[model samples]
Structures are given as C-alpha cells and as structure tokens.
Target: MGQKVRWGIIGLGNIARNFVKDLALVNEAQIYAVASRDMGKAQAFSKEYQVPNAFGSYKELFDCKEVDVVYIATPHTLHSELTIMAMDNGKHVLCEKPMGVNRVEVQKMIAAAQRNKVFLMEALWSRFNPAIKKVKETVDSGEIGSLAYLHADFAFYALDRDFEGRVLNPKLAGGSLLDIGIYPIFLSYLLLGNPDQILSTSNFHANGAEIQTSIIFKYPKAQAILYSGFTSRSEMKAEISGEKGTIYIPGRWHEAQGFTIDRNNENEEIKLPTTGRGYYYEINEVHACLSQGKLESDLWSHQNSLDLITIMDTVRKQNGIVFPFEE
Candidate 1:
C-alpha cells in the first residue's frame, strides 16, 4: 500500500492500449511497466505509452518489485496462467474477462490470489461503465419495479480474417461466446442474478468454434435473451423491462452514455459522461481496494466472476464448444 498504485500491462493488445489511455486519467495510478512476448512490440508499446520499463516476457514484469499490480490483457486461454503467475510473484491482478476458459481455471486463479493474499479481479469493465451504473441505480431505487426481462447483444464481423486468428481459432480459445458474448451474458447476470436455467444455441465454424450464439436465460419470474457473434453485426442495444416501466440503454450499452426510464406516469433520460474509455473507473476501484488493503472489488467480486464464467461454461457446453485447453 503506497501513495500511488503502480501497474504493469501484460499484453500489448488494443484493450491494453485503451486501459493505458484511461490510466492517464487516474491520479492514483501509474503505468510502470509493460510486457509482451515480442521484445520489439513491448518496447514500442512502452515508448508509446511512456511506461517506465518494458519486458520481453510476462515473467519479467511479474518479477519487477516496483510493479504493484498486473493488468492481464492476454488471450482467454492465457488468463489463468498469467494471473496465477502474477499472483505467485506477489502482484495484484486485473485480468481480462471470461476470466478463464472454464470454472477450473477460474478456481485456480482465485486459489492463487487467496494463497498469495493479493488482490484479483476479472476486468469486466462494463460493470463500471457510467451508463450501466445509472441503469443499476434506477432499478435498485424501486422505480423499475419487479424486473421482468432483459435483452442484450454484442456482435461484430471477424469471419473474413485468417481462420487462425484468435476469434476463430480453437487453440487460442477463440469464439464469439468468449470474445464478445461475455458482455451480454455479464449484463444479464448483473441485471438479474444467475438464472435458474439456460438454453443456448450456436452456429459453429468448421473448426468448431462458436461463430454465433443465442441464449435464453430463464428465472422464476424473469428471463434474459442474449446474443453474441463474430459472423455478423448487432445493434448492441440493451433493454431491461420491469413491471412498472422499462430502461433502454443505447447501443454499445456497456460504455459511456445514458439510459431512459419509462415509468407509470413519465419518461426521463439520464446521461453520464465518462473519463477516457471508462477503464479508468475500474483502475480507480483497484486503487481504492489496494489502498484499503482489500483483496477484491465489491463491485466485481470473485464470486461474481465465478458466476459469470460458470454461466459461460454452461452455454459453451450446451453448444458443444470446448477449447483445447479444457481437454
């Protein structure tokens, strides 16, 4: 626990770039190091981001004594390994989503964090988005009444790329479900607790990765219709219907925007502008937890991560999609 929390970026991907850009907005955070499999890439990213140090390998970043935390932006299959490595080296971890390929991997990561007595969280950055926060607040205020159903989807076209790319390759744990699907799934989990049952279907590429997926999550009195895909584009809008009224979150609903609440007597729009890409909020949460000597974020707790991935696991299982790492 120091005056400033020093963080290291583990992969030089697009998400990492967004995260670093957001870190600039956090006064309590400092990007001290970056690591990538390629030394050239690592050095380039460090230079671009003005990070203090660059490492040719993730292990080097983990070993750096000055790095208080590691932001894991590696692929889904690598999340468990890199997270455990950082935790073993006594560094807190902010791992990217679909925290693991399965429940077993997530459990191992959590075990390492507990054993090391360090902080760990799945970087489901959407939960910290300004728009989503306002939606949750409105629902909790009893204005939304009893939740009836929720619908969300995230989709984008990546089919024309190399079949070996991460989104289509089985070796890298590629699939729409893990890549973009986790967002809508996470939304459902946030608005409604884990459902009582899940019915999922997906169209698989010849290589066996899920290309598109649709899920129906059934609860006692509520339901969620969710979709994700790599073969097409979606509106990316999210809707939550409650007994009293409805809340509409605009497309890219997970990010900086607002929501409109339709009540019995009136309709109102709420706007929330975010700093940077909104990853800054999660970084702020991490800094606060570390400053307070806490091990995980209350907003995105370990159990919540487990629940999200568990739901994903079930969806994948239902669709007959399994990664090589799982076997």
Candidate 2:
C-alpha cells in the first residue's frame, strides 16, 4: 500500500476507542497519536492502541508533523474548534457527526479547510455503511417505486446516566437532537433531499437538554417522519414506504446489517454485514480521498455537511432548542 494516513485522535472517549479499533482494520491508516485533557488517559489510550505518541493537550497531537488526519471525537460543542485547529495546523480532519452545534460553526469549519487547503469531512459513518449504501442503491433503482413516506427512530434510555453529563448537558450541546436525531435526519436528506417544509417539537429535561424530539420533513413528493429521544428505548427501526413497496431496516437501523423489502406482499431480506463497528467504511473513504489528493469526500461533501447542519439548525429553532455556547 501507499503511505498510511497517520491518524491522531483528539478524544479518548468510548467512541474514539471504537473508531480506533476500526481504524486498525484499514490498511491505509495508522494510529500515530492520541490526546486527552488528562495526560493519564491519553497515555492509557496510546498504550492500548499501540500508538506512537500521546499528549495531554490536543494541540500537541495536532502539531505532530507525522499525523495526516485528526479525528475529532470530542463533544459536539468542541467539534468546530478542534476541526478548525487541526486544519489550521495543516492536518486533515474527520470530525464526528452533527459536525457542529449549528450551521455557523459548520460554515467556519468548511471555510477553514478551504483556506488551509486540507481535507475535511463530517464523520457521519452510517452514510458509508454497507447496508445503508445498499438501501440507497435500492431506493435509487425505483424498486420501491414513487417514494411516498419514510419513518425512522433512534432512541435509548439515558436517564440513568449522569444528568449533568454530555447526554443531558446543555453546555455540551447535548440532546436527543444532536446526539442520535441526526442519523434519521441524515437518512431523510440522503433519500429525499432538503425538505420543502419542516415541523419539529422537542421535550426537554429539567436541565434544559432535550429529552425527546419529533420531526417531520415535508418534501414536494414525499414526507419523512423521524423521532429521537433519551427518555426511553425505541425499536430503532427505519422504514421507507413507496407507492408500490416498502423497505424495512431492522432495529438499531443506524448500524443495520440487513434490510427487508416488501413488494406486492412478498418480503425479501438482504444481508450485508459490516466489519468492525461499521466505522471502517468511512475510514476507507478518508484514505481514498487523501490518496487521490482530494480535499473533501465527494460522497459526503462539504455541501452535504452544510445542508445537514442547516436542516438541524431549523429543527432546533422550531423546537426552541438553543445551546448556551452559541454566540
């Protein structure tokens, strides 16, 4: 293979660990460095991943000349800052989903990448998943003919976790909307494009963080109903219904391994398993972009990130959800 894309992880959280595990599966990728606000945690993560360097501060990892890309797995509030920092330092970036708390931050991030002439992408990994890709292909093929409706839900019971933690902390931009709602919203946008009209409502925790959110995207020819929450566990299934048929993605649809299509009352399931937590697909996309000297992924382009964030901003506004951190 060509030169491995040296990866530097800026957060040592569980998501970061899972991402590194999948990174290991990519031949064109290597874990070069990791950082955490806590030096001990950084050291521990580095040792566990067999990385070459560890730092207590994110800047140290960002400055590593050997690091080609830095994956920002920090909280939603930190995504914009770290992405801009990494790109400003001449490193490419793959920031975790939501990309930013709102549209303004995402715009700044995209501009920074352009000004610095470095690669950048929002790590909406589900878009690259094998099953999701197949779903897209099936939809585009008109097998589900004349799409009429789409329904998706992503939720989990998180009330047991720390109320002041990221899941329910407004300071961190925590809420069902940014945390898990983006998946269903993304699926809608991916399949139907921007909605002509959007309707949204949210139920908030006592701490001002949203506990549950319901959104409806009205397209010229279709409608997508989406729900997300931390108040309870949902089946997490997604269904795409058309005039002639319907496709069902089983529970935990975001990481779905298979999907069933029902046409004229006949159901068929197609299995497409992913290797390792499904993060490897996006990692491979980053590898391909860097290898081709591209600054952004064509599959999940900057425009797509902008559009997604814009949709999110609208939903938050409609539901009266605003983070304290936004200026």
Candidate 3:
C-alpha cells in the first residue's frame, strides 16, 4: 500500500472510460495500468488516460506489481472469471455491477477474495450516490414514518442496436432485468430488505432474450412494484411511500441529482449533486476499505452481492429466462 492506490482497469469500454475520469477526481487513486485483448486498444486507452502501463491481456495487468486494485469492467459473463483471476494474482477487485450473472458465480468470486485475503466489491455505484444516501437517512430518521410501499422503473429502447451486441446477446447474459432492472430491484431491497415472496413475469424478444420484466416483491407490511424493459422508454422514476408521507425521486432515480421529500402535505426538494459521473463515491469507498486493510466493503459486502444475485436468480427462474451459455 503506497500513498496512492494504484488501479488497473481490465476493460477499456465506455463504462471503463467514465470510471477512469472519476478516478482522476480521487487524489489517492491513479490509473496505473489498463488492459484489453487488442494491444492497440490497450495502448490507446493507456495513452489517452496517461497510464504508465498497458497490457494486451488481463493476466499481465493482474500480475503487474505496480497495480494494487483492478477494476473489472468487462461484460456480465466475464465478471466472475476475471475477478477471481485478479484476486488470485494478489490484486484486489472492484467488479462492475451484477457482480456475476448468477448467485453461484458471485459465491465463487467472494470465496476467491476471502482465500486471497484481498478486498473485493461490486461496483453498484447507485448505492454510493448522495441522493440515495439521503433517502436512507431520511427513512431511518423516521421522517417518512413507517414505509408502506415503493415503486420504481428503469426502461430504454435498445431494439435498434445490433442483435449480437452485449445488450441483446444471449451469450453475454443480456437482458433488461440483469442489465438495467437491477436498479429498481436494488432500491426495493435497500429500503425493504429481501421480500417474503417474489412474483415476476417477463416479455422475451424473438431471439429468446428478455426485453421486459415486471416484479412484485411482497413483504409482511409493505410491497414494492418494480419494472425494467428495453422495448420502450420510461420515466425512470422511483417513489417511496409511508404512513406519514412519501419521498419522490424524479426521473433517472438511480443516478439521481436530487429528490423530493413530502411530509405533512408539504413538499421540499433536496439537491445533492455529484462531482463527476457519480462513480467517485464508490471509488472513495474502495480506497477507504483498502486503507483500513479490510477485504470487503461494509456498505456493499460480499453477502450483499450474493443476496442480490440470488434474488435475480429467483426472478429469472420464475420468468423462464435462461441464458444459452448457462450450464
């Protein structure tokens, strides 16, 4: 552990670029290396980010002694393998969301991190957002009374994209649920914890990929309605209702810039903007955990990742959405 945390990025995709931009915002972090299957792409990304090292393969980046933690920004299907590999090579990991395609894979990734005695976290950036933090604080402070219900949705149009692309490809575990739906589901889980019963249904594309998913999480005293789809656009709003009043997170709630809290028939809007693309908060969490010599984040623990994936697994099973590559 040096004065600055050395970061190695395993993928140079759009998300990876955004993450690097936020990395620059963290004074204790630096992009030490980057890797891509294509040497040219790796070299170009390295040069663009002013990273000192670039590797043609992920293994090289994992083996780089200068690198401390590796950010796994590859596709959903590759997360488990790459994360375990990085941990095995004596490097910590901050894997991109969904952690893995299923609970089984998430279990393996967590085991690897524990065995290697290195920190590991799922990059669920929304959990680290200031708006989300405030929402939690308000709820816990009894400002909203007892929670009664919640509704959230995330939807977009992706039919125009290539069918073989990551959003539509079955091999990549592509689907609205795992790709974008997780946000709504996560919000429900964050506020209500795991549900007593989960009822779900999905609409599939011609290629057997799921395009839309609707879930109803039933709790003892509350319920959550969640929806995610790729066939059309949605308001992307989230609402939390309680006995006293309600909290409204406007469109794009997952990465929301602000939220409205209504109590006693009076609505007040609270704005909490991000420094970058809202990824800096999670990066800061990683730095804090590693600096404390902890192998898992208290906010987004390994068990938390496993629980989320298990919920998705149940939803997928109920909806009969199975990826082609799954055994």
Candidate 4:
C-alpha cells in the first residue's frame, strides 16, 4: 500500500458531514485533524469522526505538521482566504467550489500554490464523476455527432428557509448561482468549451441576494440553456443534443448515477455507479496526484477552475449579481 495522505478539514457544516463519510471510504486518506472557529464544535466533530486532533481555529490546523492537506468547506467568500493560508503553510488544499467569490480570488489561490510549490484544487467533485467522465469521452469521440444544444438545470425549494441563513445572506455570498448553478454551467462548458456569447437574467431578494438565475451560452455551432434558483424545485436532468442523437443524464445530473444515449430513435442506457456520495473519486484523485508528487490533477487543472469562475463572473456582471465581498 502507498503512504496515506493526512487530511485536515475545516468547517463542519452539512456538506462537510457528507464529505467525511466519503473520506472514510478512501483507503489512502487519513483524518489527521479538523478545525472550526468554535472549539466545542471542533472537538465534537473530531470525536464523532475519530480524528486524531481538533483545533479551535483554522490556523492551528494549517500549522500542524501531521496534516499534509486541508479541505476548506467554508462559505464561498472564505474559500480564497483559507485556501491560500493552507498553501502558504506548505500544506496542500482541496477547497470546495466555486473556489472563490470571483475570478480574482481564484487567481490569488492559484498563485499561492505555485509560490508554495504545494498542491491545490477546487473541490469540484463532479469533474471526477464517472458518469460525467464517460459522457465527456463519448461526446469527444463524435458518437454524439456535432453538438447542437445543451440543457441542464439545478434548483431546490428554499424560499421558506430563514432569510439570515446562507442561502439568502449576502455577507456569506449566498445565492443559487454559486451554490447550484455551477453544475449546469460546468456541464455546458465541458461539452461545448467556452461560448462565443453569454446572456443571463437574475432575480434578487430584498437583501440583494440573487435568488434565481437563467443563462444562455451561445456557441458558434451550439447553444446551452441553463437555470439555477431557490424559488422552487427544478428537474435536475441534463440533456446534450446533436445532429445524430441526444444524450440524457437523469435528474441530479451533477452526481449522476448513469446516462443514456439516443441514436436512430432508440435509447440505450448506461450505468456508472459511484463510491460514497461520489466524493471518493476526487479524494482518490488527490491521493494519486500527491503520490506522484504533482501540484494539481490534470483532470481538473487550475485552468479549468479559473475558466469556470470566469464564466460565472461574466454571468454575474450581466445580471448585477454582485457579492458584498467583491465590492
């Protein structure tokens, strides 16, 4: 067996809870420590996960010599700050996506990695998803013919939640766009590359948090229709259509279980099961890269993270969906 990669995680939120469960499934990963602003919360998480150490603040985890990498699961606004801190401490990073609140922050994070000569990656787990990977391969192989159109959406009913919560809180950079919109945007960008033009519309709450956003990315040979909102539940299915046939990824396509291809008016289904909430794949990628003494995964390189943020930045600029931190 290869040497285990010691991981320290910060932010003990719902997403972090799911991530820890999946981390347990990766044989080469070790829960060296976890940190949170609240010492009590940090201790509780460490006890629950059976981690070796717990720290009251993020810097403690970064300074810990036993921890080789840190997973930043904090709010979008805090991503850049925490990731750079980790890298500056000579620890690698797997910061959760959007990677930053905007493109500038992402660039800073990437620069930190290069300056420190440490690994860094946005935790965009979907990029390593088996079903999505196969679909990308199929499209690249010309099996789907020349792509003409793509449709993908991600939405959930969250209007009833507390206004002060993350979903509606401008201070936290909370909104549907960065929260769920990245999925559809990722699918479109993966299949069609950057669009020639992008048009977008957004609705905002009284507090200036963007509640909903619909975007259209126009390519020379193709177009993508994407939507993300907190107004109501949307069909999370994703469709990529071409001249010869169409490929359909069923609901919750970001963590899709499988996909289908329709050719000659016949539908053929394919299943690609993932291990443990689909985070194991990315965790494995990180381990593989670390073992190979690499700074980033080729599958989801630094450029990919920057491009994804750049696209969202354009969409935000078009619709006036500015986060407070960016100001």
Compare the candidates by lDDT and give the number of the best one. Answer: 3
Model 3: residues with Cα > 4 Å off, grouped in runs:
none
TM-scores of all predicted structures = 0.97, 0.98, 0.99, 0.98
Highest-TM-score candidate: 3
38-78 in candidate 4: lDDT tens per residue?
99999999999898899999999999998998999998888
RMSD (CA, Å), each prediction? 1.1, 1.1, 0.8, 1.2
Between prediction 2 and prediction 3, which has the larger lDDT? 3
Q: All models: lDDT? A: 0.90, 0.92, 0.94, 0.92
Q: On residues 37-139, what C-alpha lDDT tens digit does candidate 2 reach at each position?
A: 9999999998988988999999988888888889999989999999999999999999999898889899999999999999999999999999999999999
> Considering lDDT, which of the candidate structures 1 and 2 is the better prediction for this target?
2
Better of 1 and 3 by lDDT: 3
Q: Provide the lDDT at 266 for model 2.
A: 98
Residue-level error in angstroms, candidate 1, position 124: 0.4
**Which scores better on TM-score, 2 or 3?**
3
Candidate 4 pairs with clashing backbones: none
Q: Kindly give the stretch of ten consecutive residues in candidate 4 with the minimal lDDT sum.
A: 318-327
Cα shift from native, residue 123, model 1 (Å) = 0.4
Off by over 4 Å in 2: none
lDDT per residue (tens digit) for residues 1-327 in model 3: 879999999878999999999999999998899999999999999899899999999988988988999999999999999999999999999999999999989999999998999999999999999999899889888888889999999999998988888898888899899999999999999889999999999999999889999999999999999999999999999999999989999999999898998989899999999889999999999999988889998888988898899999999999898998885
